[model samples]
Target chain A: MPDTLFKPRMNADIKRRSYYSKFIFNSHFLIFLTIAGGVFLYSLLGLLQTLESSIWLDMIAALLMSMLLLPGYRSLLKPADGIFLLPYETRMDAYFKDAGRYSLMLGISKVITGAVVALLILTVGHDTFVISLFLLLSLLHYIANFHINKRAINTQISRIGMTPVLFIVNILSLMLVLQHPAWLVLSLILLFAMGKYVKRREHRYLDWNAYIEHEEVQLNRYYRNVSMFTNVSHLEKQFKRRKYLDPLLWKPKGASFNKEKMYEFLFYRTFARDHDLPMIILRLIILFGIIMVWMGNIYLSVVIGLFGIYVIVLQMSQIYSAQAYLLWPKVWPVDRTFIQRSYVTYSHKSVFVISLIFGIIFAAIHPALFYIAVVFPVWGYLTNRIFSRTVYKKEQELSD
Target chain B: MVLQIEHLTGGYSKTPVIHDVSLNINKGEIVGLIGLNGAGKSTTIKHILGLLRPHSGEIRVDGITIGENAEDYRRHLAYIPETPVLYEELTLKEHIQMTAMAYGIGEETALERAGDLLKIFRLDTKINMFPTHFSKGMKQKVMLVCAFLARPDLYIIDEPFLGLDPLGIDSLIDLMVEERNGGRSILMSTHILATAEKYCDRFAIIDNGKMVAEGSLDALRDEFNMHGASLDEVYLKITGGGIDNA
Candidate 1:
């Protein structure tokens, strides 16, 4: 090879930004936000913004904030996360030195931030034991986090399933600190020792392939959920990149009558049998609950109900957004009727029916306002009529 | 007739990817489609599958036009996409059963065929497992199994061999031969000239949305005046030499 043409491989540092970005958008962030936001909003509103309501909420806020600070605090796992720099296995010790400094700083930052927040809340009670215990528990949380994170980064085990285990341990420790004051320092030391042991054991023997594979799997699942916001293909591409997406779902088992039937089958299989429906259901419930909570007056309830209707309609529209024929129909064994009929039957009619079902359910929940139910059929008709005449027509016209 | 395309001219939009393309595969024939990355192989397959409508052409399955009876037209052909498009929600077995139901294949037969396919693909252990857990090769195998389970008259497969292990490739070749011998026709597009040369009875080389040269390997070799050359040599000579006008 010519000396001038020789190019060194790209360093892993450059790839770390994109990798961490995937974690930020993963469902874990969403779950964390739901928990943190719910508590914050409830405390602010329900307690009339009282500064000294409950210690547990403050503890939760600390935990949630610690999670948010993870990107910055990831340096604490230098021993485990540094394995990426091991290709030059000779310089592994040098990489570990830098990584350890990074991890300790990050680990300390998380511990301090959490301890301060908990201490602020604990100050209202003016109990030294409460403040000391909260600090100890906060330290234990960082230690526990460092341990699991190293295990996950090293072993490539999914961190999502491990979260519940971590959460249980965390909650148990928090309870012990809050309700039992004597064992706080001892427990904190024990947790730190445990985390150190895990890091040492992980460093002793590591399987890089298993770790890389697990990381991609975790990243794909995270990215897949996030990609829904902007694009489905992005998520699809992520799975493709990770070699994670499976083809077993849409495999041909037998004959489809024609392209139309094939499309209809896809539409049904995509929506009715797919997870998007349950997701749709969940969003509806959440929105309904929010509306119910804020429905202080009748007028507000109706306004929320109308907004709910729009949300349902919007959600139903998303059901058909994943059209495979848009990309993969070149070798399909059917006709133009399949495309045309699929739009009319699959996208147009199906969404209309789903909106109606949801609309009626929303109406039944508030029967005192029976007049809202009138929008059920009107919205259904109007949506379909508008979609068929404009969108569906545009689709067909473009098809030609 | 197993599959037929006449004067097909269509693409994503008005810009036709396949122009006036015509081809046919009768019962028991394996017709290979050869092309470069952007050679419109997939577009032509899309037209045949009814994913796209020709600006001016007709595609028929079993002598019946697709538009005249949409259901019947799709019933006759099974398609395996280059990259299998599968639902993330459904389990592997559920995918098989649902497809069987759509095609109106009896449940018992679908299950038996599915089981056999799973065994052949070494996926018998993962029947209940979701595609989420499957490897790329495993997912591709799942797609193949699903297509094979259809047992349609025409099998339209695109880039069938990519991502397969040697065992998988061998099994696929055996399956293709078995399917063809059993009176089924196959329309497959591939860049693996060696594999196509070995298996395909006839072939059509398409370039930039136009049919460049099409015939048996011997005929293609003779046309290029490279009698003893392999399919790769013939292909390179024909493509590198440029398309001679019909």
Candidate 2:
């Protein structure tokens, strides 16, 4: 064993590992699981059927909860934290191969769960063709997992690449149903074969660097979106500060005396840098805009508000992902007064921003329902302030 | 005394890495902690810094135990970890500011002190740069600046010379001497016995989590019966027997 095997030569590596470990395990994994699990549950619950336009929307949601969420789940759930195990460069192949297999198992599980949910929901209407299609696709996706796992182990194939080519082929198969039957079936089989082939090629080469790079990109992307969701200002500050971002710099007049301003700094920074917020925003814009244009149900607006609540929770969790615990000011002669005050202000500011956006959007949906939106934002802001303040106080007490 | 560790026995958890290790340094003194890997130099430092909970010992910083008032106890000491730990999101300026804020330095004083320290470390141009952009030596410089910002009574530095260029190493030694002259104490760990021998006022040698030997060059030399020999000679005489270099 090298003298430095367990001992990091530098404090930075130890500190970085320490800091990131908290994030990867506690905050990052928790948030990923929460979002993925919540969506899966929501889809399973058949909650969106109230706004039910077509079976296609439900299918899409199920598909999203399966494919996109699984990729995310895979990233967080994989053994990135146990990187020390791969200390021997010679063992990298075997180590990552196991990791790849683990990822594939997770992917297969997600595919199976999704198919079961789809089958249950679709079987109620008794569409034999669609039912058969779902099963066929599920089986193909499951079989494709070994390939996906191999690809991940061998190469830099992204989540973007790991997408079910069979799903697209099935859709194409659907499109070509009337004109060319045999070719459609053949295309679907070929697409599955291609996915399997690419996966094999990836395994054959075992491109460790590429796989690591791919994983890094996925993590960065996730963190970026989460950071954006949590604090838009922080993200902007890190990147290029937009002229529009400057307006938020001014502390709301009366609240200026309060530490909300400090939180605003952290909040804005969190959203701007995290991955969850931007993903949520993109999701909200695409989802809500579509619902408004097509469905236009006032009741669905309530659903949107609830979804916004989920989004807000996700955004808040991203702050936790930054793992402030590892950055304990205990080592420094930090001003207890300032940290105490700033902690409260930070959480409050986050709540206020979330409530404001949800309130304004919900109110804009209908002028008559403006009170619900208004009350919700105000109530949420105050409640979160009180709750988070208590939590911070309690933590401080524990530390003391 | 600047730092005092008495009977410290702690490690990751349950199993102790440092077994009843006791050591101390007075004001204006430079003490070296020398050990092979897994000999628990870092663990000993962690106890002194109060980062670890001693299963059976007491750690005092400038005459106050960490249990008395952790925050206040910390005020007397600054630490340079073996590897630099920086906030990737924060710019170098922000890191300095954060450190300043934590230490309760006024913003103006923090900035002024930060400026001087940055210049001293030859990092004036990189204040606006994020730590993510810093090279290994530059990151180490940032950690050094942060540690020096407080000018505490004691500096508990772990593996200070790693990743430093020869000039950087020289400057660090100069800084250590300068700080000691200013009535601060430094307890540092290193594999570089020659530098440690040249600069340290006293030395403690730990092996297998136990203190094998300690004292000034002459004292160690006398103890090991190697008269007028260097610290290395004494060190080798004490530890070279049946010890795996690997």
Candidate 3:
């Protein structure tokens, strides 16, 4: 709570960042950034010369500003703070204030880049006053969006949903402001609505666990993004926090939150977070959907749907396989059969969702055969049941 | 008796690492399973936990053999390994919740007990944080919190103090004592002989894949003929030499 508490922590964090920054901002990254930035700037300037004032430019400006304006809140809070800082939690607001300042300072380059892009493109249509007003509205939206996001960390609210809605609101507001200065009132109202929606809950105290988990997720994201540019040691846990899909995850209540259903709990998380499974499954659906749409032949669509269901069902087995061998299942007092049952439960809903997507894709390709789209889910359920049986057999053999 | 092992001999492979190792822990007792490296302490613990099939003997918890009723056998026992083994995906709170679920404890009751244990170990607030990123000591504390939260009859702890700080060690000792007072049992395998001598009610010494001597401190001293000797001294004398003890 003391002003001094965060200073040393910030310095240490800076040092740690500097350590990884060298790896991230290596010669290769600089080269990539320069060439990519140069090409993008050149193309934009060239477009500006030929382009006229139009709504398309306004749309682009709105979209770009909205996309980049959500500079994520970073508190730099560690897991230990949940314990070590509890006595001082009431007074830790000063520390978080420091963290907010640092985060904004850290995000200045991103905000500026967004502004520059907006300014560069807005020059296509608008005069100085409107452009200035648009920028001012965007900056206000950015600040509001950032604070709301920070507040969401301490509540049970869905942060994932807030982000996309923020994106849409930013785009809507920026476009309205650009349309006419009088519309800025609507933009301001939209921003206030978002703020009210986000901060609806009252957090009596800091949710240290939430804050720390959020921090770790952010840190992992930084490392994960940087790892694409260069190898980083901190990216070992490939858990992509798919917070959006979490609503579908089993929210066990008092009665259902027992040993009989622990695996069901784990199965949902493993499918969503661990191993690139969800993304991979989503990609498979999209890829097969594309193929089905491309080859509009009804027969080909059915074939793609069958194979897609088969592949996705097979993919669902991986989470079960990974969990079966973990130490806790063996140690936990529950029967191993419960794990297989949980797998079936997980495969049931997840495969159905994937199959439904494929079905829609099929329906898009063949409108008259909508009834046949039902076969995809049936086929998916059958394959999953069979695959789950195979897993049980394999697990039985291993145990035997 | 909470855990009854009769001449249990087992290892990962067909060849036994612990041979004819017999140990019994009574209700309300804290028994230390003392041994050197490669001295079959973990093998014995594993056999008791039903993780390894004994080549020669059998183990029972709460008068139930694993084959008779595996879940019931496991339900009565909790094992904390030398190195903390945790789920990479589950958060600390989930681990405790999973423990409660596995033990058939009511969700609210398990959480209430876990809250008390977590507070004792200074981990109540970090419950939602993942253990994967925790330091070794913090992870060990999580293991302790989960194990104690279960309130099982017999706790099998292998090198329980390996990664624990002094405060953590003290908290664990206090919890063990409290659990014992509540008529539960603990089978702890620790290298910290001094602490074990001071706290553990009984001592079981294993050397060369066999339990050589086991009893109370004075009882073990009588068997080893080392009157007034410290536990380290008695342990060395039983295991035969510092070379193998190290």
| Top DockQ hit | 3
- How would you encode candidate 1's per-residue C-alpha lDDT over B109-228 as one tens digit per residue? 888999988888899888776675688888899899989998889998999998899999999999999999999999999988899999999998887787878788889888878989
Higher-DockQ candidate of 1 and 2 = 1
The Cα error of candidate 1 at residue A367, in Å, is 8.5
Q: After TM-score superposition, what is the CA distance of residue A263 in candidate 2 from its true location, in Å?
A: 8.4
Chain A accuracy as TM-score for every candidate: 0.58, 0.58, 0.60
Q: After superposition, how far is residue A203 of candidate 1 from its true place, in Å?
A: 2.3
Best by lDDT: 3
Residues A64-161 of candidate 3 have per-residue lDDT tens digits of 88887787777887787778888887777688899898877777777788889889999987999999998888789878888888888878888788
For model 1, the stretches where C-alpha displacement exceeds 4 angstroms are A1-148, A155-165, A172-184, A204-232, A236-280, A283-318, A324-400, B1-29, B34-78, B82-85, B88-155, B159-186, B190-201, B205-213, B217-246
Candidates by TM-score, descending order = 2, 3, 1
Tens digit of lDDT per residue, candidate 1, span A198-264? 5664654555555555545544554455433323333443112112334422333334433336566
Find the number of clashing residue pairs for candidate 3: 1
Global lDDT of model 3: 0.82
- Give the C-alpha miss distance for residue A94 in model 3, angstroms: 58
Give the number of the best model, judged by TM-score. Answer: 2
What RMSD value applies to candidate 3? 12.6
Task: Point out the worst 10-residue segment of candidate 2 chain B by lDDT.
Answer: B237-246
